[model samples]
Structure formats: structure tokens, C-alpha cells
Target: MTGKRATQLALLGVVILLVAGLVTGAIGAAITGRDPLLPTPGIHLAPQLITGEARGETTKEVFSTDFVLTNTILSSLITSVLLVGLFWLGTSRLKVVPGRLQSMLELIVEGLLGFMESVIGAARSRSLLPLIATIFLFVLFNAWLGLIPIYQSFGITRWTDLSLTELSKAHVTDVKGKPTITVEDLKHVVEAREAAAISASGKSEAAVEKEAHKFAETNRIEITDAGTIGKQLVVDGNPVTVEGQRYAGKAAEKIQEAGGKVKTAQAGLSAAFLRPAGTDFNMPLALAIISFFFIEILGLRALGLGYLSKFNFIGSLLRFKLIDAFVRFLELVSELVRLLSFTFRLFGNMAAGEILVLLSAFLVPFVITDIVYGLELFVGLIQAVVFAGLTIVFAAVAVAGHEEEGHTAAPEHKQPEHGGGHS
Candidate 1:
């Protein structure tokens, strides 16, 4: 076949798939009284547990986990390894005629270094290149690598259940001397009812008790294989059989109650084994803190003790210049405020991007999601640049000497002259 013919055939296939996806996706499923081709993906703000025992069943239990290993951590590790491996490959062998890998690496570094020199001097930019470049690469790769299909396609299934024995122990008598369960206690009440149902259905006392004990325990969560994730779902420990594309949630529950093993939810619900580190608040906050530390360090190096004077309200207050003292205080607050601004800016954008992609896939499937993915690639690059570029800019401002408006401009700091530089 000719290349042009092959291209035309590929396009035709794509168009057909797009049409079929729309017909079977969320909208079409709703109209047809059938399960959607894709289940509604759940949104989670906090990073999901990969290997840890939470205090409770929900994400709120995250705070109390014993040595939690979250999906975001896995993602960061993978990103780090990828970066290290690529750099190693590029520099491990020297070539007068550069290979593609080396050339690509050089292009990125040289472009980033030139940009930095425009903000700070060439010497200073070169000196800080390691920190700034690493930051940019880490953020960029973490965002981009997450776009891979495997990141959230497979992970620990989300499981929740009621515990009757725990509920009974949690009850208390109210002022009216009547037994009443709080709304919070309702989750546990279902276990007792389920146990009785099993007993009525010809299960022996011991068997019923054992089944009851299982319900009284916290929901069992296990990792689903990537190969079977979207196709076969296990709820409460039982593999759910789909009739056509639909699985009934109530029917699954009934099966569990009647002593047939099943898991929670209609379609198997799962948390990803790896999520974009940028989507987690901690990842961005950590980067911001590291950036803040380096900025202050650079300021101190360039200005010595004079740098501390920016926040030195005591001298102004002792001189009874309350206004100047207030301004100094504001400056200090602004410095701290940068941490929050940096954290939320990256976190919000990445999280929102992730949600948009998932929703696009769920609602329209094949065609629209590809477009959204392309947009995300651009967004990821922009966010990485903004984050690293801001770090360099802030460092520059920090090191630049300050002069009072009415006073003679202070002589430029000699520190930057040493190696930091305007040349």
C-alpha cells in the first residue's frame, strides 16, 4: 500500500472510533439505560495510598497512616529515574558529531542557560544553572510523564464497608433514654443487616458469624493488575461480572450479603498506583520551600548581612519610624507569602488539568480526550518554565542592592562582581 493510502485509512479508522466512542460514552449510556463504556472517574484531592494502613477507610484517614507510600511518591521516583537515565545516556559517551540524545540535551540546557543569563548576568546564571535546570526538568518531566496511559490506569481498588460490631460499640444513650444512631454511624449499620440476611438464606450460625466478622472488618483493598483493570473489576473481594456493559451496584451488594464474595461499587473503583507529583500539594510546596531557601541563600551571599536589613524592623522602630518598620514587616510577610503562592499555583493547575483529562475521557472518550491531552502537553511545558523562571527572577531581586528614595543610591554590591555578575 502507498504511504498516502495508509494515512487516509488511519484517519478513517480514527473517525469511526470517535463516532463509536460518543455513542457508547456517558451521554449515550444514559440515553440507552446501559452502563457507559467508561465508568465515571472519581476525583481525589489528596494522594491515594499505595502501600500503607490508614486509620480509617476514607482519605481523611491519610493523616494517620503508618508509613504511607502514596502514588504521587511513586510518580516522583519514576520521574527522577527517567531524568537520571536520560542525562546519563546523553553524557556517558563523548561524540564530536553529536548523537540525537546529546544534541537534544545540549539544546535544552543551552536554551535554558541563555534565558537565565538575560535575567541575571552570565556568570551568575551559569553558577545557578544546576539548581534552576534541575527544577525545570523535574517539574516538566513529572507533568509530562504522567500523561502516559499507565500512570492512573491501574492501582489499589477503592473499597468501603460497614462494621456492625464496631457500630454497636460506638452507640450511646441520648437524653430521651432511646437508642439512636448518628448519621456517622450509618455506614456500620449495614453489616448487621447483611449478616442476618445471610443467616436467613440457610447459612449456619458459624458461617453467618464468620461472614458478619468480614463485614465488621475494614474494607479489603488490593492492587489490580494493569492488564485487567478496566476490563475486570473486583469489589469486596469478588470479581464483578458485567451484563453487556452494565453492572448493578445494588445487585453486587446483595451478592455480598448472600455470602457470594464481591467487592464494593458497581464497576471496580480504583486509585492509581502512580499519579503526577505536580498534582499533589506537597510536591509543589516542597519545591517552593527549596526555591525559597536558595533565594535567601543567594541574597545573603550577594549582600552579606546587608541582605537581612530588608526585614530589620528593629532599627526603624528604635528610631520611632513606625511607617518604615511597618513597611519592613510587610516585606517579610511578602517573602513568606511567596511560598503559598508558588505551592497553590502549580498544585491548582496540575490538579485541574488532571480532572479535565479524566472528565473528557469519561464524557466523550477517544477524540475529545486526544485534543485535551495535546493541550495538557503545552500547559505542562508552560508551567515548568514559569516555575523555574520565577525562581531565577526572585533570586535576582533578592541579590540586587536596595537604596532609599531620598538617600544617595548605595554603591552596587561588590558580591555579584566577584562571580555572581552583570557581564
Candidate 2:
């Protein structure tokens, strides 16, 4: 590597690290004595997960937004743009002895092409290289995209959450048999939640009481309406609103007035991204449609009438008319099964992989999460390769099938003419 090239590589690596840190908010976190969080259940180290009072599920939005720009997107885009800029500069310079970065990129492309050739042969690989590369890029981008922690770190729009458990419900009930809006009622409700949690978990009464007291001591809450907008109330010069007569603090009121940032939560259904690899119906169904079309096209192009041999279009097997028809139909089902199998296989694998990484991160801190993370990255890449590679192999078989058995068909037809001539 020339001095310039070496410098460029070092710079590029630093840029990546910097951008990754920004996206994950790791640099700032390290400075602030915080940790990177994996999106998971049971615990949320950062406010990103959006939680409410304890005691089970939180359906309330931690944050909500309508297509608001997030830090994650910004960081990922910056990283990608910088990487591209560097590549362009290096490639355009066109060094007879390429810079280290250029040389490295070349190696990656060559290695990938070589791998594809091994899987589908040089001729077919050449034809399918573009698709394979597209798949590779998609996988790479999607895997890296989530590393940006901007949106995770801070969000603008949040949801109104209310804890309405049976126990809390009781604590708030007034002397007149109505849930009153009072500090005493709120305190009692908080305590009730603790009791309920321990009881539901089948814990000792003493433990539940201790925990209930602990939670009450720690939480400073001012309950508001369950609606999207909080109703305003002036309680002692401080703005307050009651949800079920529970107060909303002046702090929440002030932020709401000044237009505090809105948080954009995930708006899409999880299923779309989480669909397993080939295990889901989509991948294989796609494969089946794509594979079968080419198969038929090749079958027709090469075998012509002989392609019907797949259905006993020739020979004495047709003598058992019923059996022949049944066999042909059965073979047709194989095409459909291939598609079904491909979809679920990929969906199951990818979904499982993504979920595992999430859960593992929740189990431990990020520092020791390298092994599980590496495994996830590996699985995602392999799945991408397999899906694309199989597509190529199917295409090849479809194109080549007719050519291989093409001669057999003409001979069979000739035998029929010869018999007719004898008769």
C-alpha cells in the first residue's frame, strides 16, 4: 500500500467507527457512562424502549411519530455516503498499483464472483452475477442499518400509558364507592400494583410488600388522560390534568406547550421484516414461480413434445392411462412444494436469527455480545447467498434440461412413424 492508500484506509476505518459510534450512540454513551441497548423485552436501559408503570405489558407508546427523521437513518446514511465517496476517489485515481482500499474492494468482488461460479458454473454465474450482487448489498445494508441509535436514543412523540390493574383499581376507590382523583389514592394504587405483581408471580407476601414499597418510593408519576392529547388543568398555578383524576405534572405540561420532540415508533407490522427465510411461503413461492417458468421455457425450447415425457408423453407407461395421469399430476405438485418450502425456510431462519440477537442482548450487556452478534451476521449473509444461489441453479437446470434429453424425443417419434409405415 502506498502512503496515500494506507492513509486513506486508516481514515476510512476511523470514519466507519465514528459513524457506527454515532448510530449506536456508543461514543456519547461511553462519555456519559451509559451502554448501548439491544431492543428487547424485560428491561430497557435506555428510554428508547418506551415503558410505563411496572406490572406486565406496556401497550402504551413509549414514542410515536409520523415518518419523522431519526438519528439512526442519519448516521447510516452518513456512513454509506462517506464510504462511497472514498471508493469513487480511489477508483477514479486509477493507480497502476492500486491503493490498499481499491485493492481490498477488488478482492471482495473477485472472491464473491468466484464463489458464485463454484455454485452455478461460470457460464450461469456470469448471467446471474447482478442478482447475486444485489442480494449481497441488500443483506449488508439491512444488517448495518439498525446500528444507528439516534432514534433509539431520543424520540419526540410518545404515547399516553395508563396502568389499570384490578388492584390499582381497588386502591383508587373512594369512600363513596368511586375512584377519586387524590394523592392518597395514587399512592395506594402504586402499592396495589406491587402486591399484584408478586402474587401473580407466586412470590412470598413479604417479598411483595417490600417490592411494592420500593417501587412506590422510586416512581414519581402524574397520571394523565389515556387519549392522544392530554386535557389541561390548573392545580395550584401548576398545569395539571387528571386521567381518572390522577395528575399530570407541570414538567410534562411545559414540554407539551413548548412542543417537545415527538418520538417515531415503528409504524410497520413486524411480520414483514421478520418473516422467516425459505420457511415462509413467500420465498419458495417466488422460487417456484420463477423456477418453474424457466423450467418450462427450457423444457419447451429443448424437448418440444418430448418435454411431455415428464408426464409420460411417451412410451408404454401411457398404457396405464389412469396411473400415468396420476403420476403427471403428482409431479406437478413438486413444483408447488418447492416454492412453499423455500419461503418458510428463509422466513423461519431470518426471523429466528433476528429474534435471537435481540433476546441475547437483553440477557447480557453489549460488551460480551460479540459471539452472538457474529453468529447473527453470519446467518443473515448465508441466507442471502442461499436464496440467490438456488435461484441461479434452478434457472440453469431449466435451461439445460431439454438439451440433455433432447435427442431421445426425436427417436421416439421416429419409431411411431416406422410402425405406421409397416402397418
Candidate 3:
């Protein structure tokens, strides 16, 4: 009785000390103006620059790829690698009496396999195990990485600052070591040219100067109205008149030919090449489309062409009647259903997950987003697995007709080591 009492007292003392330590830490954090409980803000993942055209080069807008691919895809890739590496490391050294690591893996895998076997039965489960395992691992890795603080935000950058309108304007690129005609600078050249022509043609000096000034005030360069300033000034060398804007263009070319200069502004070598994360819809769509296609492929490989029949209704008819003729009749619908199902399934889940995370973050500080962060990770993995698994299941069931492989009787379930069999 005494020993029990003492043990309880000791445990109580330790708990009190732990509480005291926590309180002290909290107090210190408050005093330091640091909210230790808050999640750190992730790096921004938006394109900074839409680089405009340069002189001499074609006026092209370069899509800025500052933080998009680097932060999102790179992290996903890393997570995938780690998952593959860990599973590889653990499984490669398998033994009859598993080590602690292997045992832990076996527990997870065994659970998954058991679940799959029950759903798919022995024959199909064995055949689909490898693909299912790969999907499960890839998904889990993507999900787990999404939960990591570093993955969400780190090592960010901006390439340039350019407005949509300004970015659309053409910048000069063909610098010939001489000043060239720019749209704005055309006014000055027109003013000088019109004044000179008027003076040379014997107009009164005051009238000529007044007309030139009038043109300059409005155009700030040349009198380009009708054929006054914009007209061609030379045929080989003797001056004549033609029509249009760009008086300075002719002069600038002449000046360049007669000893003038130009230059090019190059982007810094450190400029980033990947688009910012979430800035565009292409990445997510690509992810959805690719995963969906793969899923169908998985189903096709597992089940056969017969597997793809009844995603809608055509397959049901073809099953009863072997009319390869009717195949095209319902193909559009079948393909659309399969394609849309895969696309929407992924798009809807990802979009929802994204919006939910954003709302949560907006309501609470980033520091408070740990729960959602983990949720996103789970959602990503589940979506990936569900997508791939469904593909395989549909294909397997479709092609094989749910009964009678070569053998007279079904074999004992050879449950997969992953829960990717059907559901």
C-alpha cells in the first residue's frame, strides 16, 4: 500500500513539472512576441514576371515560372521518391523473422492486402497487386508531403514585375549600336521634318515654325497628318513624300546607318523557369487527366477490352450480343463517361480540398492550419489511390465477366499487399 502511494505521488510530481515547463515556454514565447503555436507562413507561389519583348528580338511574352513547379511538383517528386525508397529499403531485406521495421510494414501491408483480397478475391488480387501497391505508395507519399510545412512553403522567388497591358507592348530588340524609332519618340522627328520641309519650300519662317510647333505639341515630334510628316522622305536619296505613321522609324534607320547605337536587356541568369503553384489550372487538370488515363489503362490491362463495355449502357448490350459493329455506336458516350468521371472525380476532390484549406487558413492563422494540412495530405493520397484502384477494378470486372477464369474452380484468395484491389 505504501509503495503504491509513493509511485502515484512520483507520477503526480513529474506531471506537475511537465506542466510547469509548458507554462514557462508559453510565457517566454509571449514575452518574445512570437506566437509559437502559430504555423509559419509558407512561401508565396505566384509568377512575378511576364517578361515583355526586347529590341531586335520578336516581341514575345515569356510566362513567368518563378515558384510554381519548384515548390509544388518538386516537392511531390521528392515525397514520391522517399516513399519508394523507404518501401524498397524495408522490403528488400525481408526475412522469415521480420525486424521491427519490417514488422511495422507487414502490419500495414497485411491489413491492406486482407482488405483487397476480400473485395477482389484470389485470382484478380494476385494479378493486380503490383499496380495497386505502386498507386497506394505514390498516393500516400503525395499526401504525406502535402502535410509537411516545408512542402507547402519554402524557397520562393519572383522573376519579374510586369503588368498585363505593359507586358503586351513590344520592346525594341534590334539594337544596331544606334538609337531606333520608338512609338513615343516619333513625335520629335515628325516635328523637325515638317518644319524643315516647310522652310525649304519657301514658307514664311514664322508660319513654318508655328506649323511645326503645332504638330510637335500634339504629336511631340513630326506632322504626320495626311502625307505631311508620315510620308516617305527619300527615293534613293532625293526627298519625296509617301504616307503613314513612323516618321522616326525612317530617321532612326538612317541614323543607325549613319553612325548610331542600340542595346538589349537580358534577364538575369538566376531567373526561375517553373510556374508558381496554384496560379494556373493546367497543372491540376494535367494531373487529373493523366491519372485518369492511367487508371483506365490499368483496368484495360487487368480486365481486357471487354472490361470497358458498361461504364454506361453499350457494354451491357455487347455483352449479350457480340456485335463489334455496335462498338462505334456507343463509343462517344462510353469514352465521355469514362473521361469525365475520371476528370471530375479528381478535379472535384482537389478543388474542394484546396478551397477548404484556403477557408481554414483565412479563418485561422497559418499556424493553426496543421489539421487541414494533414487533411490535404490524406485527401491527395486517397484521391490518387481511389482513382487508380477504380480503374483497375472496373477493367478487371469488365473484361473477365465476374466468373470463370481458365480453372474449373476459383483458387483461394491471394490477397494483395495493398488495399488497391477494388474500392
lDDT of each: 0.71, 0.47, 0.48
Residue 330 in model 1: lDDT: 70
- Model 1 residue 290 CA deviation in Å: 0.3
Instruction: Summarize candidate 2's per-residue lDDT along 137-200 as a digit string, tens digits.
Output: 4445444443322322233333232343331343234356454444444445445544554465
Q: What are the per-residue Cα lDDT tens digits for candidate 3 across 162-181?
A: 32122223222244422344
The per-residue C-alpha lDDT of model 3 at residue 201 equals 69
User: TM-scores of all models?
Assistant: 0.71, 0.46, 0.46
Could you tell me how far off, in angstroms, the CA of residue 79 lies in candidate 2 after the best superposition? 11
Winner of 1 and 2 under TM-score: 1
- C-alpha positional error of residue 403 in candidate 1 after TM-score superposition, expressed in Å: 7.7
List residue ranges in candidate 2 displaced over 4 A: 1-96, 144-157, 161-327, 366-368, 405-423
Model 3: CA > 4 A from native: 1-71, 159-335, 366-371, 402-423
Q: lDDT tens digits, residues 1-423, model 1? A: 699999999999999989877887897788888767665566778776766755554332223447788889989998999999999999999698999999999999999999999998898998999999999999999999889887676655443342333322222224453334432343343355446556656889999889877855634322232211222223255443343113334433433443333323334444567889999999999999999999999999988998888688889889996656666777799999998999999999899999999888888888989999999999899999999999999998887765432132223223333333344
